[model samples]
Target: MATSTFRVNVLLKEGVLDVQGKAIESSLPELGVSSISNVRVGKLIEFSFDHEGSSLTDEEQTKLTKVCHELFSNPVIESYTLTEVK
Candidate 1:
């Protein structure tokens, strides 16, 4: 079996209100950083898979994406992208 690495990046949708980002944005000026306009917070998830080949097949990749969407991310508020690194 070969090994594969997957990287998942999840971020809030555009126009979605991020309270944490807003707070950080508000505090930037107080910290003497006035050039900052806006801020957004997101998450990065990395994991590896053991497969027979160097990478997963297209069907396998699609199944993995479905699993990610159903289990790892909120479809309404968050969007995610998956990449194979190795």
Candidate 2:
């Protein structure tokens, strides 16, 4: 069996309200930095799976992506990207 690492990048949808990001944006001017316009926050997740890369097919990858979409991400407010890495 081979083990592969995967990286997941998650971000808020455009026009979504981010309270934390909003707070950061509001505070930037107090710190004497006035060039910033907007801010958004996001999450990054990484994990590994053990499987036979030689045999695991594209269908399996699709299945995994669907599982991620269903279980790991909120479709209403966020989007995610999954990538296989060595």
Candidate 3:
């Protein structure tokens, strides 16, 4: 059977305070790692399906995006981008 992979990049929206990201950024100077600004963190989630390429229909992609928004991301402060991995 043919198989494929896709990914969802989940990240906090701009202007939202990212405590973890800030802490890491502030700590970097202490650790002697400089020049790293705008150090925001995000998550990558991959999904494997028993389908080939972008064979999944638009409706299927829509449903999967909905799932990503509802189940994987916090709509209040987070947004996500979906990509079909080759």
Distance (Å) between predicted and true CA of 10, model 1? 0.5
Deviation in Å, model 1, residue 44 alpha carbon: 1.0
Clashing pairs in 3: none
> Runs in model 3 with CA error above 4 Å?
51-54
lDDT of 3 by residue, 1-86 (tens): 56778898999999999888999998998989998999888888998766434477676677787889898899899999988787
Span of ten consecutive residues with least summed lDDT in model 3: 48-57
lDDT of 2 by residue, 1-86 (tens): 88778888888998889888999999998899988876887887888777766656787787778867887788899998888776
Question: Residue 16 of model 2: what lDDT?
Answer: 89
Q: How close is candidate 1 to the true structure, as a TM-score?
A: 0.84
The digit string of per-residue lDDT tens for model 1 on 4-86 reads 78888988999899888999998998899988876888888898776666657887777788878997789899999988774
Candidates in order: C-alpha RMSD to true structure:
1.6, 2.0, 1.9
Residue 17 lDDT in candidate 2: 91
Model 1 pairs in collision? none
